[model samples]
Each structure stands twice: as C-alpha cells, then as structure tokens.
Target: MPNYAESHRDLDSYISARVPVIGMRTIEQQRALRLVREVATHPRRSSMPFWIYTRATGLRDLRTNAPLQEDRSLTGAMEYAASQFTARPNATLVLVDPDDLEGDTPLTRHIAEVARLAGNNSGSIILLTDTPVWSGLQRLGMSLQLDLPDADEMYGVLAGFLTDHQGIIPIAWSEDDARRAAETLLGVTEAEAVNLMATVAAKGSVDKDDVPALAQSKDRIFSDLTGLVKVQLKDADYTVGGLSNLRDWLRRKNQLMQADLRHTEIRPPRGVLLVGVPGCGKSLSAKAIAAEWKLPLYRLDMGAIHGKYLGESEGRFREALETADRVAPCVLWIDEIEKGLAGRDDGTGVPQRIIGQFLFWLQESRSRAFVVATANDVRSLPPELLRKGRFDELFFVDLPDAQDRKEIIQLYYRRYVKAEPDPDQLARLVDLSEGFAGSDIEGALHDVGAEVYLGGGAEALRPSFVMDTFANTIPLSRNNPEQIEEIRAWGRERAVAAGRTAGATTQGAPGPARRIVFMED
Candidate 1:
C-alpha cells in the first residue's frame, strides 16, 4: 500500500529546482542518488545543472578512479568546481570538506563565498556528512531538507535487490515485513545492504524466513563489536511461583505487542527495572522472558563497556544501542544495574554524563530493544532513575514464600535428581528452607548431595544429613532483617511482588490485585 517510488519522485522534483542545498538522511545512498538523478532529468527542468558536493570524509574522485589530491581540501575543491563548471550548466556540483567546515572552523567563510559564486553561475551546491553540520550553512540561506526513503521507496529497493539474484517472487512478500526490514536498514548505506544481500543469497535462497537472520547478521557486521544478542522468551506456564502481579503485567505487554502488529505504528514499552534480593531468580526472569517471546538474549557487561579514552565510553554506548535497533525485537539484559551505575561518582562527571545520555536514549529511542535491568540495591540509584516513565514497571523480588520454595525445590530436583523423590520429603525440605531465597535452597540441596558422597553411598547418609545443612545455613533474611524489611517496605506500594499472588502482602498491608495470565500452554 505504501509507495516509495512516488515519494522518491516528489523528493527529486524539490531538489532539481536550484534548491541551493539538500539534506538526505537515509541508510541507502544509492537510493538517494537515484532520486537526485530523477530530479536532474525532470521534463519541466530546462537545462542540466552542474553540482558541487561536500563530504566531511574525502570523496573518491570518479574521474581518475583514485582519491584526488585536492579532495582533502574543501576550499580548493570548491574553487576548482567554480572555475571548471562556470560556463557548463544550471547547477554545479561542489564537494565540500566536512572537517574544514565543522565547529568553529573557517569553512563557514569558504561556504559563503562558494554560495555567492554558485548564485552568480546560476547553479547549486550540496553538502554531505556523517553528522549534519547544517547550523553554519543555514545562516547563509542554504537550508533545504529532503525526506528519506518512505515505505514505498524501501519496498522498491528491496524488490529490486531480490529480483536481481532470485528472479521473480515465488510467493508475494508481505509489505509490512518489507517495510520493517527497510526501517531496520535505516542509517545503513545502499551499497552495504546490496553487498549484505549478495552474501546472504550466495549461501541460499533469500526467502522470508531468512530475512530475520540476515537482518541480524548485517547489523553484527556494521555496528561495531558490542551488538545486540537475540533471546527467546520463556514459557510463562513453566515459570516458578511468586510474583502474581508481574505475570499480569507481562500479559499487558503481550497485548501491546499484538496491537502494534495491527496498527503498523507502535511505540515499544520503555523497559523494566527488577530490584530485590540477589539469587532470587531476578536474572533468571530476564532469560525466561526472552525464551517466552522467542527472541535472542544479550547480557550487557558494564565492565566491557567502560573505556579508558575520553570519548570511547560514549561511543561504545551509542554502538550498543544502534546494534539493538539494527537487530530489532530483542532483549538486552543489564545484570546488577546498580553496580554498573555505582562507579558513576568518580567526580569527573563522565559517568554521570553517560548515565544521563543512556536515560535520554531510553526515553526517546524508537528501537525495539526490551531492556531488563536487574538491581539488588535500590538506594545506590539516583532518584531521577526511579521516576515513573524511566521503566514500565519496577518489580521487587523477595525471598520465596513456602509455596514458592516448594515449587523451586521441585523444579531443581526434577532437573538434577536421577530418581523421583517423595512429594512429602520435598514439602518437608521446603519448610526447613523457610526464609531462604531460591539460591540458598539450591545450595542446601548441593550440601545434601555432598554429605551423601562423603559418606561413601546414598544409603550411608540419612535425610537428617540434608536437614542439618538447611538448619545451619542462616538465611539472609535473618542475618540482615533490617535491610530486607526496609527494601520490602519501600517496594510495597510502588513495586509489584514477583512469584506470588498479586494482592499478597510483602510486609503487612494489602495491595492492588494483579490479574494473572499465562502466555504458554
């Protein structure tokens, strides 16, 4: 339904009329050039135009098939274009140097002079750069912005690519899928996409199923080392007990995902902040959700992100976000988020600035990265981060209650134990492990096995051996009652209790009831 070819035609018309300057922000450079070519050959246009193009990075000289010696200097290139094309046509193409003109540079003076020369010759100039440094040029009456390839244009480009190698379509491609793929290619060049498609097609047929994988691989190649990793969401029905309210919240999120498919325009949920006791399955939930959604999972290691250089940290952060966008509809796991932000107070303000940038990106980004940030200490985080809009929901993971503990014990025993254990024995073990988190219960089970091994055989050690380990291990709740109570009190009203009834009390008072919905059979 969307027509990209028509959009390209409209853009071409606007540029050919001596528009002075045009800004094109798109992934496909060839498509941009094609639009320019269309405008150049418009029937309504009387004469051909000579144009001068400027790039921050040196441009390859098409004439010599080599880098031009003069290409390094914008002033010289403009002067040469002005002299050479003075008598030729309606528009003169001059390529300007971005570095020579960027931030507080004398390039502004040269641009003005070049603009005046172009006006005298009845031609126009175009400037291209990675970053649009247009403020300087805008003041000199040189500000014409062009739209990037719309849905229709993208479809044409993709169709052309597919047709060139694979021939006619065996089955009609879904326009929605094609448009999404095009949008994912945003900020990527046409040459890059063509080359990537060529590589993919070389392996096998470039069909619909291959699109998702190809899209992910292309992003991995271009966006630097720290790209997004795809993770599949877990089966909700198989998830162990506790946060009843959290389950309800996930149902709403699923509903949103479905709604987005229908409308073709959906803003992704902001993210989630999971804070509570350590080893309480906070990190596990992240992986479970990924498996549940049938997406890829990538864990963000803060240690890997911190760079020694002045600007490297920011660069790394940007690259990470870009990678996530390129490999859309994936999860990014940030474990111990508080620890990552803990190093923020170095006094140099670099870390603070980075945090601010991350927050801004989280709020404004249109990427499909569903962030799942886990933290054990909430006090270490800044107050601004706790604000409502930063995360879709803040869920507290407390120590497992009796029911939850029983479920966890069953899950682990079913996974690791060779023989089926008695249900009564499992209930007794769960009762003994009261006040203990899931991790502690697992550790206790490990201790039981160790005792049996040390005694030379399973028959040598009685059930009392396991019970002794459970009794001796002081739970974190007993060792640090004040801290645990404080966290529970703080998260009582504001946070949803995970792995329990929606209306279950974490401390003493009743909260709002959460509606539980299973995402799997």
Candidate 2:
C-alpha cells in the first residue's frame, strides 16, 4: 500500500512522462484497463501504438479491444509489445495480471528487456496486477498501488447513482447520512459500491434506515483475508456492559473516522490500548466498538501466526498486515497481545525483531484500521509499546463497581434469559454479582440460559437460578486478589480509567508524562 501522506496522480501523467515498466497494483483489472485506455486515447497520445495482454485473453489491440490472434503465450505478448516500442516511438503496453511477473524468470527478463527498449523511446510499458512485481523489474521505472475509494470519493459515487434514480423512486438519505453510508462501504471498489447501491434501491427506495445495513451488506463482499479471522458481531455486541469512559471516547473519535478528511491534515484515531482486569469487558469492548461503528471486526491471533522456519513469522505477519490494509476503515482486535510480543527473550532475538516490526507498522501505517488491543498483564508489555503516541490512548479497565456490575447483570440477563429482570430482581442479582467481572456475570447468565434451554425454555428460568449461579461462581479477582490489586495500582498511576467508580466526579484520560514544543526562530 502507498503511504497515506503520498499524493496519487492521474494515469495520464505516466504516459506524458513516458514512464517505462509502470507497475500498478489493483484488484479492479477492468477498471485499471479502462484508465489505461483513457490515457492512451488522450489527444497527445492518440497516435501512439497501444497493446494489452492477459493470460486468458492473450494479446489485443487497445484501440478496438480486439485480439491480434497470434502466438498467445506470454512470450508472444512481450515480443509484440517490445517490437512496437522499437518499431515506433511513444507506444504503450498494458499487462493485466500476467503470470510469472514476480520473480527473475524468462517472462520477467523479457519484460525488463521490453522496458529498456520502451525507455529508450518515448513509450510506456505498464504492468498492472493485484500482486507485487519483481523489484528489479519495478526499479526500472515507477510503481503505484491503487487503493479503493475513500469516503469522499465513495460519497460522490453514491450521490451520482442515487441522483439518477431520484424521480424514479423514494430517496430519503441527506448528504450527511449518505456520507456515513459511504464510510461504511470504504473497502469496496467503485463497481462494488454501485452494485450495493442498486441492492439498496432494488426495493424502489433508498432510505436512511438502510445505513446500518450497509455494513451488513458489505459482509457479502469481504476480501479473502489471510491469518486475520473475521469476527461476527451479534446485535447484543453493540451494547457492552461497562467502560463508559472508553465508550464516550470512541463516540467522539467516530466523527473523525466517518468524516471526509481528504481535505484535512488530521487522521482518524489509530486505536486504543485497553489494559485492565481479565473478563472486565476489555475484549468485548473491541467487538462493541466495531459493532457500534457499523464496521467489520477482525481478530489478529498473534499466537497462531508464529512459524518455526526462519523469517516465516515475519512474512506471515506482513501478509496479514497487508490484508488489513486492503480492508481498512475496520477494527483490528489483538486479544491478550502480550502473550505473543512479550515473553522471555529465548536468545533467538525473534521476539525483539517482531516487536520492532509491529511497532513500526503501528506508527507509520496510514490505513484507517482502528486497532483495539487488549492486555491483562500490562506490566509484561515492553515500555516502548506504551509510549505517549504509540496508541491514541491507553485505557485502564478496572473491575466493575456495584453500578457497573448491575448494568452487566441486566444486559446479560436480558440477552441470554430472553426477558428483563424486574427492579427488585435486578437489585438482588446486582448485589449477588459484586466483585464479579463482566465475563463472570455473563458466564453465570450463560449457565442459566443453558439450564433453561435444557429443562424447557424461558418459562423455566427464574431469578433464583441466576442468583445461585452468581453465588457459586468464583471470579478471577477473588481467586487471585494480590495480582489484581497490583494491576489496578499500576493503572491508577499510569493510565486513564475506563469506568468511573462510585462517587467519582469525573472520568480521567491519560495525561502525558512530559511535553515538547517547537517554534520558529
């Protein structure tokens, strides 16, 4: 992926500059072909000889999209493209998803030879693919990694299609809501976005009610991501048990995420580090944020990515990160992150190398991937990972207080038991669940749900059943009190509180330990 700070150019610029071996990466092959065609048909380049090649289609004339019907092998395509540059000046060739382009093979060498021939003349040879080309070949010219439309561009697409259908049907989305809808569809191509618009208007109306459904609809076209597991969010996941501070912060940052910031210098929040007690909704909060924002949720299992072969882990990690970039404007959940990046230095130095790589990616990545990393052992994390600007914020999620515990009870009770607990029942259950983590409360409710499911149904479920389950359950906080307090003490001094305790007047955010400022002399 190109750096977010870099500006993209019109394809015509390459032809005007007479760039040879122009390596372009895009999944939308036809779209890219059309762009190349447009550049070729421009008045200045109108008289230039143009050719295109694909393994399936063989060689074709760019003018008519007509096949030349000769040697259909890659050798024939390069032979043809090479002859054009040598025979005439200012010619152009487009190779679309050709095989054997990545390494120093016969085809790669031929392309390099063709590139040199074209370079000597005022001609261009374009290598268009969704995959990377060989570095040696690419270095002969320039490269561009085409990305999907950002929010502003996507909004234009949505408005154009909907405008054409304005008088034909009901269209209820205003510009703001339409923009939000477009933000939800960020990972899709322009063609895919148009098709999705058709799906929305298929029923003869495009209403604001369909906005949330955009994320749901986008699930149909998610890219085949490797190593990163897609996490499906339930409706209940939209409402987490506690962490009011974290929730409020997310709500505020969401505006920036959905805004058309193409014209602005500020970027969206990179993400937050949630360090807190186990089962205090740290992991669940990541899901809740994605659900609330109506974005796709993906979990990067750091533990599963480790490989025994040399540099195998780094390669897999790179692939996964690339996949994340491909599907941006989404949530990346790294649960129990310390388990992977932090461990006893086994003298291999692999852990340090991986940590360095991860930190660098986190700092420099321009994709709008909101990373929600949760860690129970905050102390185990390397100090550099917690630097002031590494994450947007580091939130400390302490064990839920009585009020938070009550909300947790009610939320899970309503979700799992299929009914709301009455006020008195809620009060009794809240008292029973004191010192319980959100997961502990949820687990007890799950037990009730399972028992009710086995015995009969919701009719068989009772408040006593929930109370008894909570009573018998021993939360991790109680099972290991000393460790919990140690974590709490560390958080109290260093991190911001995710949930305010009883009688606390104001929630806190992490304050910088030091400050720096520069001014013109």
Candidate 3:
C-alpha cells in the first residue's frame, strides 16, 4: 500500500481547488482511499463528508466506517450519493475498481453526469484504478499518478522496517548499509520495499552482502518483459580496443556511476551514442562498458519489440522501458539502432508514434539504465535523435588507425597463436591490415589459426601466413567505398572521434571536392 501521509497533501489540494473528477491511478487502492478520507476530514478542506463505494461494500460513510445497506447496488448507491450532494454540497465520493464504468454505456453517462453535478456544488467524484484503461473518464478527470518511492522515501521505509523488527528479528544493518540498500531498491513500491526488506531480515541479518541478491530480485520482478535480455557476464573477459577517448570518458564517470553515492551532487552519465563503420567495435563497446563497470547489461532488441497487432508494439516498448527503470544502475545496449528507426517515416504511422514515445523516454526518464545505442548508418536516423542533448555525446568510431591496428594484431596473436609476434613481424602485419576493421583483423587471425590445424602441426603457423591472409581479404572500406566516404563525412563534422588522434587515418581519404551521398544499401 502507498503511504497516505506522502500523498494526502496533493489529494487535499486537488479537492480544495474543486477539481470535480479526479483519477487516482495507483495499484494501492486501500492507501488511496485512506488518503481521500484524511483529506476530506482535514479542517483546511472544510471537513467535507466522504463516501467510498465498491461493488462488494456498496456505498459507505468514510468517517464512521458504516455502510448504507439500502444503497448496496451500483445504481442505487450512485443515485443516493448524487441526491446527498444537494444537501451536503461539499462532499466527496470515491469509487474503486471503476474500470467497467469507463465506456459510453448508460452507467458511464450517469457517472459523467454525476461528476458535472458534483462540480456545480463543491463535491468531487474520485475514481481509483490499478490499471488505468479508461480513456473516456480520463478526459473528464485530472489523473494523478502516485509513483513508486523515491530514494529518500525508500530510505525512510528501510530504516523504519529495521527499527520495527530490531529486537524481535535480530536484524543487522548499519546506517550506511541501509542507505545503500535503499538506493538499490529505488523503483519498487513502498509495499514491495517492505516485503523485500522483510525477506532479507527473515534470514536473521541484512548486510551489504545482500545487495547483489536485491539486484537479482529486481531482475525477477521484470522477467515477464520481452525484447529485454539480461546479459550474463560470468567468465566474459572481452574489451574494446583503441577507443582511447571513449575509454577515458568512461573512466572519468566511474565514481558517479556508483548508485550508493546518492549524496553526491554530481549527476551520473546518461550514456553515449556510438555511430561509425560496421564491425568497428561499436556494439562490442556497449558490452564492454557493462563489463568494465561491473554492472548488469540488458540488450533492448528494438526489432523483436515490434508486434503486428495494433498497439502491441507500443505496449511492449513501454514495458521494456519500465523494466529498465525497475532494474536501474544497469546498461541498456541497443545494437544497430538505425535499423529499427530506418522505415520510421513510412505510411502506417506506427513507427513514427513509436519514435515519439522513444524520444520522450530518452529525454525524460530518470532511471539509471545508461543507454548505449550503436548505429551503423547515421543518415537514416532522425535528425531529432542526433541533437546535442539526446545523448551525452555522439562518438564516431572509424576504422582502426595504424597504432590501433598494431595493438589489435598483437592482441589476436597472443589470443590464438599463444605467442607475441616479433617486433618486425608485428610491424609488417599492422601495415598489411590497413583499412581492416577490428572484426576483419580478428577474422583473418582465426583463418590463420585454422590453417595450422588443417596442416596437422602447430609449427605450420607462421607470421608470413598471417600477413598473407589479411592482404588477400578485401575490407568493407574498399568494397563499399562510397558508403564509407559518406559515413566519414557525416562523422567528421558532427561527432567526436573515438580514437585518440583525429584527422585522416585511412588511405584514399575523401577530399573537399568529393561529393558524398547518403545511401542505405
């Protein structure tokens, strides 16, 4: 149940201002009813009489907790309440689980009419719902969404639980540990917070060791959501190479990313957009970030979220975002974002509406699910998405430079060949792999290792064979020269270089006279 004290002031202000029809959208029906009773009886609000109507209980006096048995049916209760409004002009009537009365049926019409009459007097009709599915009544009422507890409120909840169960349960938690636990449990409801803490206390102690368990609990809370895959990081030792600028930026945000440091004034990093050549570690960086931060990674598959049924796509998308919020201080990896947003301008208008929803979440979401969106084609992305505030920064990951290629070659050699190539061999391999992507270099190394197996001897693998293999493979830069040029042109002007050094690093760099046309294919 929600805390009545937390929301009573807002409810009182709404009634005092004479907002005739109020929609209290919350799952905590009992808590909302309690708040309505408290607000109605307060002296500041003129101590208006309040009535609560439910299908089971019918119409009842909120102050005395007495039922009007004669007015038990829905029609009789509403009609009786409407009659009382003429005599007790400033009264309030609340109805719970009113989802059925949201249509244009006679009952709904009567409810709307009752709302208008209640407004003429100083009375109001408050509708309470767990799932606010009624669009019709929403227009007639001012909907007030009671959100889950914020950090401070969650802290109070945790502290109160600890105090209540201290001697009885033999619980163990310091002030610091309690604060940290509250931060981890930010998105759950007040009831859920108490239940989760109670579960932890049932073990006879609540310590810092239980924080990971809390995160896993949050994961279970969101297990029903589709298109969001929880990435298991155990034994995953991958890292993105040669993006010094990106690496440094992430390192600087290391402290702020710690959710336990809620007392700090610095705002945590939202995330970055990685737009550049395919197979250039754009997607890899998203995974590597979670690994580097030791945070959970969730891949939001935008393609998988699109449903054929009407409004299904939007519902799934909203659920996915909500799940991300519930499991915060985590990384949200969206790979190949351009592919999802490519046909957004088409006829159905579904894609455009989805884009609008996505934009709203991106700008307004207060959750700590850092968004790391990777895009292969920038020109297809909406211009609004490319604006400055959409992401913390837009990084352009061009092909590995000469030095990056060298480091990558050495890395692959050590991984597959199990030996570092001699300096002369390393230099030759780097020079031969110019314009090769990280994937291309890694692929060539895999091929070189395969030859050793087929030759039936580890000694069959040589540095020359590795160099020859890479030299023969034509890179994406050469095969798609026109597209690569266009991508480079867009990145150079609008995005920060991911590599440490800037300027032309690839051969046959486009000149000022070269005309680069945007092409999807």
Candidate 4:
C-alpha cells in the first residue's frame, strides 16, 4: 500500500544480477526485512532461501522462526553463511545491527570471504545498520537507502491508526484535516509519525486542537539542539507598524505557506532578507511573520552553532537544518545573520564552510522552512550571500517616517499605556518622534508611561508626557548618524524599501519625511 515497488524492483534486480552483497542504513529494520523477503520469495523468482542474524537473536531462518542455536555468534553466523552457499546457491543472509558485532578478529575477513564465495554461487549478504559505514564492507557491496514514507503512505498510516483505535480513542478529524495532518507529518520517520498520532489520540481526540500539538511536537525535536531556539509569541498576532511593501508581499504568500506546496512545480517562497538600520523592526518582523502566518518561529542562533571539536559545528548545523525541514511550513529566523557569517572567510574556514553549507541548502532545499534572516551591517555580509537568488527578496527597513511613526506611536501607546491617543495627539507625538524607529517609539512611550504611573497614575499618561520623553531621548539613528547614513546609502541602490512612498521604483523608494508639528514643550 505504501508503494515500495521501486525499492522492491531495485532489490530484485540486484539479486538477479548476482550482486553478492547489499548494504543499507535505515531505522525501519522490520520494513526493510519484509521487503527483502518479498523480493526473495516471489513466486516467479527462483527459490532463494533467506536467513537472518543479529547479535541478540543470532542466526535464524527468514521464512520460519527457527534459529540455528549452535551458530549464533558473529563468527559462527559468517561461517554458516559461507558454508550454506556450497550446498545451496542463491541463499541470502541478512545481518541486523552489524555495528553491535564484537571485535575485528576475523569478521572482516570472513565477510570478505563470504562475498567472494557468494559471487561464484548466486548467494547474497544484506547488512543493516544505523551507524555510518566506516568499515571496508562498503567496497564489496551495493549501498542502498530507504526514504521516509510519502504523503499517501503516511495518510494510510494515519487512517489505519485511527481505525485501529476508533473504539479506544476519539478522533474528530475530517477527511481534509486528516489529509493536512498527514502532509505535516511527512519528512519524519514512520515510527515518529505513528508515535505523534498516537500521542494526539491518547489525549482522546485528533482534530484542529491536535494540529498545534503536532507542531509543538516538532519543538521537542529541536529542544536538545544547541543553535536553534523556539520563540514564544505573547500575542499570536504581533503586527509590525511599518514595512507596508514587505507586509503586502507576505500577505500574498501566506496561503501558499499554509498548504502543502511540495508537489507543485512552483518552488515555494524561500523567504526575505531584512537588511537595514539596527532599530528599524527587522528582528521584530521575524516574530511578526510567524504570528501573522500562523506558523511556528524558530530562531537559529548562528553564534551558538559552532563547537570546539572538529566537524562538530557542521554536524550540529546539518542536524539543525534537518530539524527545520522536518518541521516544514514554519518560519526560521536567523537574527543578525551577518554576525555569524562575517569574518568567516578569514581564520580556519569553519565559519566560511558553514556559510557555504547554509547558502547551498538555502538555494537547494525543497523544505518549506521560510528563512527570515536579518542583518544590520551590510558591509560585513559577503558579496556572494547578497547575490541574486540567495533570498526571494532583500528588504531595507529604514527609520520610520511620518505616517509609520504615527502608527507606531498609536500601536505602542495602546499596548504599553492601555490607552489610545486621539488623532490630534497621535499626530503631535509622531512629529515629535521624527527620525525615530518603531522600537524607539515603543521604548519612549513605555518610559513616559512608567514616569506617569509613579507620579500621577494612568491619568498622568498623556501626549505631553510622551513628547517630553521622546524629545529628551536620543534615538539610535541620531546617536549613530554615520552608521545609519552608510546603511541607507548601501540600501538606496541595492535593496527594496519596506515601506511605501511616491517616487518609488517597482523595487522600492524611501518613505515620506517626518512632518514638523510644534507641540507644547
């Protein structure tokens, strides 16, 4: 039902061609063994007897549950296998968990001898293990790999699981919900998928409520990892004040992100690279993207990816990326990505190699882990990274202008102060906070609210308080004028502005300037 026709055909072909040895790495040992039996015992094929061996189980008949008790050890099993071909050609010996085999004494030589002898006869040896192949056995054998089950297979698994537990557990999923859940459960092993579904059913129901639980299960997959962190949103709808153009683009792509777009020819959207001033809501946009899209947000701390041991960084990085893929249809936020990739070209080339791996994966991975990478300093970023096709788009989030400032003022005031400033007051606040970033507006309003709370309670928090506090506070743009100017210059020619403006190219243009309005000082 899961359609192992391709794998079966491949195995049958190898056996028919007298390939003496076959090697495969897989977690689903039972499934692989069943496939081998199916191929070996076929009605049309010659009668090829199959035997199995493991350290724990020793040597046993593949068709019958009978065991060869005397020849149970690794050496004994190898000797028995080598002897069997003399009497019975086309005998297949399957070894399970060869990594558990003790010592190097004659096991390697015996295995090699078996390979040589098996070639003369039609006998074959199949080895299975989860460990990386470090032994020379690979040279003598054809290596194969079993892929994770596809959607149709997973749906069958889910449907069968639900049917099996219908009386024992409650399942409220519609046909569509079951299909969607099966789609999300793709990329994980059959065991993992089964366990996850069982987990939901254990709670007595598998419905819309189980969907978040399924996503949260993916969080557990990343919990032990060092580099990636799960970001928790206080409000699932954490909206950004500005970035009109970028926001609109995301709005359009939202539906595509929600569905299983794997089968489609159109490559799913890779994601955007937000490059701009430090306090211009680049990082915040990452959180907002997850909230707005209704996807889990994982922050990949590039700084934490490195390790002291050799190859550890790459291994951790690969695992992290794999985990992200496993949890598809999610947002991966790499904050200040340039910091991780900067200065990588110098030194030992570890960081450079990491960047190389990241770049390659970003372009090639079919996984829908929409990457939202934010960078403050464009000069630190490598030219290759910024080249076309690295990301879907590169957006420059500059300082909030007049209209954006007003939106930020109102949004934050309502959030922190729990009171909305009327239009007249909001306009005055925006004018006073010109050249401020969305973050600056929020911070200034928060500080004013604190002072008002201490001096005169909620009634004391008014437009004048915000104006006074903002006027005294120096925003990051003002404090680091040279840095902001350099970033703006870099973005002016290369990047698309996140906000809307009049004389804009299809790419983007800087938004309108801050309007000057005199408020009581």
Best by lDDT: 2
The residue ranges of model 4 lying beyond 4 angstroms of the native Cα positions read 1-5, 70-72, 100-106, 162-179, 203-205, 208-213, 307-316, 344-352, 452-457, 460-463, 502-521
As a TM-score, model 2 comes out at: 0.82
Error of 3 at 182 (Å): 4.2
The RMSD of every model to the true structure, in order and in angstroms, is: 8.2, 9.7, 7.2, 4.6
Clashes of each: 42, 0, 0, 0
**Candidate maximizing TM-score:** 4
User: What would the per-residue lDDT of candidate 2 be over residues 150-173, giving only the tens digit for each residue?
Assistant: 667788889899889989999998
The C-alpha lDDT values of all candidates are 0.62, 0.80, 0.77, 0.76
The TM-score of predicted model 1 comes to 0.71
TM-score of each: 0.71, 0.82, 0.74, 0.85
Q: Which ranges of candidate 2 are over 4 A from the true structure?
A: 1-20, 54-59, 66-87, 111-124, 134-143, 150-153, 344-346, 415-429, 445-471, 502-521
What pairs collide in candidate 2? none
Determine the backbone clash count of candidate 3: 0
Instruction: Compose the digit string of candidate 3's lDDT tens values, residues 262-333.
Output: 656545577889998888888888888887776678999898889999899888888888888878878899
Model 2: per-residue Cα lDDT at residue 49: 84
288-358 per-residue lDDT for model 4 (tens digits): 98887667888897877888888888888888898788777688999998888877656777878888888
